[model samples]
Target: MNRPPELKRTLKNRHLQLIAIGGAIGTGLFMGSGRTISLAGPSVLFTYIIIGTFLFFVMRAMGELLLHNLQYKSFVDFTTDILNPTIGYYVGWSYWFCWVVIGMADIVAITGYTQFWWPEVPLWLPGIICIIILLTLNLLSVKLFGELEFWFALIKILAILALIGCGGYLLITSFVSTNGIQARISNLWSYGGWMPHGWSGFFAAFQIAIFAFVGIELVGTASAETDDPTTTLPAAINKIPVRVIVFYVLALTIIMTVTPWSMVAPDRSPFVNMFTLIGISAAATIINFVVLTSALSSANSGMYSTGRMLYGLSRNGVGPKVFARLSASGVPQNGLLYSCALLLIGVFLLYAEGDVMKVFTIVTTVSSICFIFVWAVILIAYLRYRRLFPEAHARSVYKMPFGIPMCYVCLIFFAFVLYLFSQDKDTLTGLVATPVWFILLTLFLPLYRQQLKKRISYTDSKHNH
Candidate 1:
């Protein structure tokens, strides 16, 4: 495959590190977690851990493969080279759809976060403006994209760390409040007990718990642009399990401990609610900023991944050739604009009255389904790649753990999660949206494939003539 001429290596290890981390820690962890807790109670922590464990292996497979081939630009390219053109087609475009839906969810969340300050400001305006601002920043340079992700990620990391530290200190100190309450780890099981809500609830939360780990594949999508992807890519992907455990598991454990499983509100952020419980009015402001950064980080990641996917699809003759155009800085301007435009449409959803969140829930469900689809395809690609190119794969170093068996296991598990979504009302959208998205993509792909094939054929015919 020909390299995009204008593409350059500008992103460094730190930028990639922060960008990967940024993508993982966002509105899902900051806000959507409460819903999970409401469903599972104290058992939600275990659900996150299990899903995280599976995702860790997925990232490991991607990291090993990426490290093996320095020239392999993105996971889409990997899919094409390893599997077949059709798999690449589905994975590339589905991944693009994944982020667009996610971007909409994040933008709606931005409107929700802003409601902290101006209750009357109407959600859609802020969501729309936020997309416009991010689009401008993305057009500038890849480094700028990296920088934005870095700082936004930094804020999220700091907030989680601070919240964890505070929760820990309060637990350790056995801090007694002026009121009747005392913060302690004992609160986790004290109210409802470990399985307070019983097996059903514990299992029910699996839908949301898995969704928290949705963007774990993000680093794989941006593999091409990073400097020295071999070392940096592995370093970034290696952090998946740790972040999943710390940011999701440990953080939630703390919230459950301090606030009690029964006390954690379903509608509000556990982070923000904890602070308010501690009588820190100032915490609302701090958490507002953190959530804003979280939203920014989410949008930033959406922009980055969406652009590269476009570039990748174009590379595979699955999208517009113009999308393959890169800036001198190696950033795909057209791709960024395209993704950001969809993100801006999220604002209208935000502004819409009467069950806007229901729409947001629908979007999130669809996004989650899209994410699962891409992930499952990657696993299939890995399975096929290893089988057909055992020699090619063996000659190279990078490989997923448990080899082909892991692929089957992950498939069953992912399929089960999809099933769980159907069983649970909270995650019904994810299940329902899969067919809806599939119908749209199935219809859309034929036209694109035809157009792209024509373009390729025309170029080939011209040369032959």
Candidate 2:
């Protein structure tokens, strides 16, 4: 007799840590922050803080639930155990859909970044190149994925540190920019004061701000393949707050300090703008390359997670069996190919729309909305776990603080963000587009569940042999 194949726990502590960091700092922070800054003014700082704080609680809830049962591969599994199997099926596929939407946005962003260097190049060319490269890298092995993320994250970190360090130097020396704007801490408040746009502007920032944190749960998905779940999972989860502060809050603080909120262009990246204003001749090229990789890193993560989610769903008979097959390297080859194929549609969008930011905004809004649903599912699962197994919650080594109350609070917060999305015309399109996915899922669910039962029975009989 032979044993069945399974996911390898080849991801080490370093891989896990860097993946966590990479997930925290997404393409949105680079490509979308300029718009958020424009919308919220200096108070955009508080927007990141507020969103990060709530999501920290969400991650804590997720960490506690995932650590409680090692057999539970991801939140999808726990949703099945604590919630219902039907809802679990929905969450699993929705999560896959969430990543696909994000992958499309990344595709658009990569094209936009590429045009910075080669203005004459077609937009679709860069996206196609990126997909092929990511597909090749991801098909090799999960460790290769980890290694890719580690280097990608390192690049992002060094880039930010350089920005912070350079911005800090400008502030300390009161160095004047080529534009004649002198750097100073008071630059944040001097232009328009904090909350310049008042609460409406602060609240408006939530739509894009939420997109920045979409992949924060990538750590949870990777936990099943992690080397030591008990140690690395908690370590990664706990640092999310600090990562959010330094990478998002602190970096933006410095950017606004050197370049006032009024001066930061909504369409261009403030990171590149900061460097260009400080008279770095190659600023646009350098930061363009960084952001290009940042989008690639995000798309790479999308490839990895969508593959695994598909593999997870297939194993439980919720998806097609072909997706359940793994390559010799223990990678989900079929799933990877399937997702990559769907991503090509994004290239078509780029050709059709001929506008990157418009496509980026609409797709990202859809991604953000779906992610909120996925996070809500985790919180619901946690509440159920507390009800069914009080002793388990009591005995847990890593407990979610204020678990019950915070669950409700996070749920309400997500709903509020959705409401914010509806108010804007651009985000409103995304808000409208999201329900189509759920409606289609509801329509086909019963047929899929019927097939699922048969598949499960056949597998059980084979094992009995």
Candidate 3:
């Protein structure tokens, strides 16, 4: 019998690595970090690292599970095999929704970044252009998509390194005050001392801090397209920690130390604000380019994930049949076009409303919560995998640390994140919308089931009838 329609293994380990980094680092850290730090004070560092650490295990459990079964395909497939097909359908569509929402946020940001170049340019123009460009890149081919994402992500990684280097220079030279805030190590402990806002503030930031790590699982999505899923998967995953430390913790530390939490502008992007504060010539243009690249990376990644998710769903006989079609280049052209068309809606919405952040936040936060749900599924899958294959769990080359206990801890932390969203006003707004979206999805589920069953039953009945 022929194999089910599946994604070809086209992505190399390098492509997978950069895609993961691109997904992990997005418009959030570039622009949103200033707001997060302002809310929680210096303790925001702890917030990022803590959430990052826990998520590392979630990915580890997922990585191990994916490697153990090369046929696992995507998280949806893994969930389907262990759980039920219903859960797979929910998770698959949930992820697609997640990326669509994230694409909107990034497009909104792209328009916002346009202000740096031509203040007179209507935001919608750039937003529309960005959508067009990303859509084209995605529809081209999977390899081209990988290449675009690779460079988009590289720009971000380089930008972070540049900032880190600059910050270190400032700290070492005891850079003099622009805002009467001298550059020094004292910034970490200064101004109301470390946890200035207390544990409540620290925990409160987790509501959205978790959002920063939302796409870290993009690596797993590439499992099917990855060359040597075994070696590449583990290699890509093993670097998650080192990436978090250098890119997240070290970079955040340098930023806070060099600029001081008090000096960072909450209204402006920390990346742009820091460069301007440090007296970089042409700072606005430099940061604008980097932010533009960041936005492009987000949109590009949004397309990649949506395409793969659709492919996975189709293999399970859940999504549109066209999504199962692949081009000679080994890319899923139909899914790419379909997802890109949906993402273009974001550009239109940005045109309609001057303020798209509310829309972006509500949608993206739902996506983040969906990510939490997906992670829980991964852990549950891991726990089940261990039970069935104890030898693999015990002697596996890449096993999750702390096994079941760690899984429980990650689950509790996710629950705590949900609680934090409920308490915070900004996040609570997003939390309120989650149920409504699910209900909208749930209301359509029966019809979806009917249509799905009708098609399958027809296929089977034809042979007998």
**RMSD in order of candidates:** 4.0, 3.4, 4.0
Report clashes for each candidate as comma-separated counts. Answer: 1, 0, 0
Ordering by lDDT: 2, 3, 1
Global lDDT of model 3: 0.79
lDDT of 1 by residue, 1-465 (tens): 956456566788998888778766656787778888887888888888888887777777777666656677777777766665666777788888888887887787788778888899966678877887888887877778888888888888998998898888878877765555688777777887778778889888876666666677877756677767777887888778788788888999988877777767788788887676666888878988898888778777888889888987886787878898887666888888888877777877755776876767776777787787777877776776676656667776555668778878888998888877788675785566568766776777776777556655654464344
Best by TM-score: 2
Model 2 Cα RMSD, 1 decimal: 3.4
Those runs of model 2 whose alpha carbons end farther than 4 Å from true positions after fitting are: 354-363, 451-465
> For candidate 2, lDDT tens digit of each residue in 238-265?
9998999899999999999898899888
For candidate 2, which ten residues in a row score worst on lDDT? 456-465
TM-score of 2: 0.94
- Tell me the tens digit of each residue's lDDT in model 3 across 212-252: 88889988987678768888888878788788888877887
Question: Candidate 3: lDDT of 357?
Answer: 54
Candidate 3 to native Cα RMSD, angstroms? 4.0
Assess every candidate by TM-score. 0.90, 0.94, 0.91
